[model samples]
Target: MKHYDYILVGAGLYSAVIAWHAKQAGKSCLVLERRSHIGGNIYCEEIEGINVHKYGAHIFHTSDRKVWDFVNSFVEFNRYTNSPVANYKGEIYNMPFNMNTFSRMWGISTPQEAKAIIDKQKSEITGEPKNLEEQAIALVGRDIYEKLVKGYTEKQWGRDCSELPSFIIKRLPVRFTYDNNYFNDLYQGIPIGGYNKLIDALFEGADIKTGVDFLAEKEKWMSMADKVVYTGAIDEYFEYCFGKLEYRTVRFETEVLDTDNYQGVAVVNYTDRETPYTRVIEHKHFEFGTQPKTVISKEYSTDWKEGMEPYYPVNNEKNQMLYQKYREKAQQQEKVFFGGRLGEYKYYDMDKVIASAMNGWEALHR
Candidate 1:
């Protein structure tokens, strides 16, 4: 039997970063992936000479220099900015509620006109915002809320806007400028090739075993290392003794089109409730590919069930309290360290995941 310093439970970004840190510190690691591939949700599959984002659309955008420089060292990122368009019924508008969107909606120009319209409509919500509907109206006004926010959000959470909590729509981006660039980050781009290249680089020296379930042979795998870095669902790891944590998972329907330009943009969100899917992602636009064909994935947001792959945590009072119980139980265990979105039951963007793993690893050694 071969023993090592660490055995990572999942081959996602958190595990990959920890593995990278271990290699940097001259330690051996054995990485185990439940899936056949290594990159987890960030993993991409090549379809029609385009790197299709296997999960949903993921665009890297961050202002942190350390995390930015670290990933760039592995592969160069293209100048791909995320400026998604919203398709409501048959009409299309720019996302993030920018001036361009306002112009398209109201047939008016200048920030003054947009502000007047929004502020006038925002007056409808009196007192404290009671629910998502009120909160969204207070932020972006009734017209934008009805046409853009209400239907899409209802589909995403699988609930009426009035029934959902106000905290969910605490802030919706409304820019006065004409800039349609979705992110305000200093740097935003995709890797020169694809995300798989970055994952491969992060785990250059680690021994990886894909298509292996670590939890099935939990004891046997635990014996292979002094400590374990687990990136699976924390509630699942504990076997739901405290009941299952709720999540909002997405169902992807991806296909390759014979024509190159399908949507003419990377992301086009269907804001109308009539549409089954929330967004459609055209893979080739991320890299400015001139390939003869294009790949697209339609994302449908739904409530997560027992066996579905959990995409994001459903933030609410009930789930948070339940996660706290699992967290306290996890602290009692001496052998395993839990990290990542699912493990912690919290949403984390890409750069934040890398930064969190790096900080955790450094703190562990210190």
Candidate 2:
């Protein structure tokens, strides 16, 4: 039997990066992925010459220079800025609650005019905001909240604004400028070709085995390696000893349209309570593809259950306390290292995930 220095539980970005680093350090690694393929949630499928995001929309944006440079080394990225449009009952407006949105909402051009309306509406909530509804109104005023925030948030969480906690939406950014850029990060773009190129580069020298469940035969796999790097749900690793952590999962309905274009932009968010799905994404627009046919995916947020692909972690008071218990138990395992969104039980963007993986590698070496 072959012995290995490390056994990675998941072949996602976190594990891929660690595997790459281990190979460079003259160490042997065995990467076991539960999914049939690698790249985790960032995996994309090409249909009609277009790279469709299989899981959901993942735009790489980061303010960190080192992180940006690190990813660029693997694959080139296209200049695709995320300027999502929100459609409220067929009415279109720019995202991030910017000046373009205010102008269309109230037909006002100046920032002062927009500010006056928001300030007046915000004053209605005089006392501390009790729930998400009041909290949103206090932050960006009633008009923006009603049309853009209320229904969309409710649909995402599967709960009404009144019932949801205020902490979920601490603040809604209301930009006074005409810029429609969704992110404030310095570097923002999509990987050219697709995210698989980056994943392929990361897995160049690593021994990867897909469609294998490490947790099923934990003792057998652990015996092959000196240490284990787990990236799956921490709760599941312990067989739900402290109960499962709550997560919000999304379902995608994708189709190839005959027409070259469907929506002009990459993302169009349906911000009305009546709309069943939250957003419709045009995959071609993400890479500026000129394919004859276009592919689109309608995203619907649903309550997560066991055996489902978990997306957003619910970091509420109850779940947080439970995760901490799992964390304490995880720390006691001297031969194991927990990382990634599910492992850490925290939401992270693509760049942040890469940065985290690099940090984890450094920690292990030092």
Candidate 3:
């Protein structure tokens, strides 16, 4: 019989932001999370004094100053820059395809020498690239594409480059500089005490319930609130009237190592076709931990089913069309509003999700 101004579903970044704004506006809000805990994929657990990124490695990087300021308000971020290395058959190279990588690969130092080498190799591709393989070759040439791109991309999508569409990799970033920083963002770092600090701060004024499936008892929850802000799968919200949308999920295999360091860097991508997992993440490196032991997670990409934890939205032609239909149906519902990665059927970074939720809150208030 308790009335609430808003019933926010999912308790992820999107829902947390909405609930925060709702509190600021003097509105009573309730957050219902299907999982046992909050923070969604960004949730971290402390093991051996190291915060393990449970789902996968989530590096918070954003060019937006507003979003940067917004998140920093909750928790202070450490000066952690993502400079991932690629291990191709025991040979290591820096990521973002920079001059350092070029130097290591072909003993070329200057940008001019690297450009010439790439340009020469790129010329091999004839007019109008058809597939991801051809498009990548056309962009950065065969050497970089073969060693760095092909296998990693193949593992991520669970498909070969030739079979996938060119639009999947519209542009392979080829940095001519010596910069190995993965992102060109103005603000980037991991939260000092892990992402849970931020999530806990965000949900301060909201009533939260975990291990509760909103869809199971939809009507009961819906009646308590004036409006429902759903951040779960859009198809699930509407009972998949237009069929299910496809997604690429990830499986994490985490281990506690006896040694201080497992991998020198935070992220090391295995760019070999034979490698089962795409990347190995050393969690301690993310926070500059000098612990006696370290925790690492090997990430494997998999096809998402109804019960699996959906990670990346496969925004291909068919899925997009189906999502559009669901979106239309969502808009027709007067009391329900959809947001976040799953609800929108789009891949969004953490910063973008926060900005989106803030925007959604503003729109709802207006």
Candidate 3 residue spans exceeding 4 A from truth: none
lDDT, model 1: 0.93
Model 3: worst 10 consecutive residues (lDDT sum)? 357-366
- Model 3 quality (TM-score): 0.99
Count of backbone collisions in candidate 2:
0
Taking the candidates one at a time, how many backbone clashes does each contain?
Answer: 0, 0, 0
Give the lDDT of residue 8 in candidate 2.
93
Off by over 4 Å in 1: none
Lowest lDDT block of 10, candidate 2: 357-366
Clash-forming residue pairs, model 1: none
lDDT of 3 by residue, 1-366 (tens): 899999999989999899888888899999999999999999999999999999899999999999998999888999999999999999999999999999999997899999999999999999999999999999999999999999999999999999999999888788989999999898899999999999999999899999999999999999999999999999998898899999999998999999998889999999999999999999999999999999999999999987899989998899999999999999899999999999999899998999899899987866
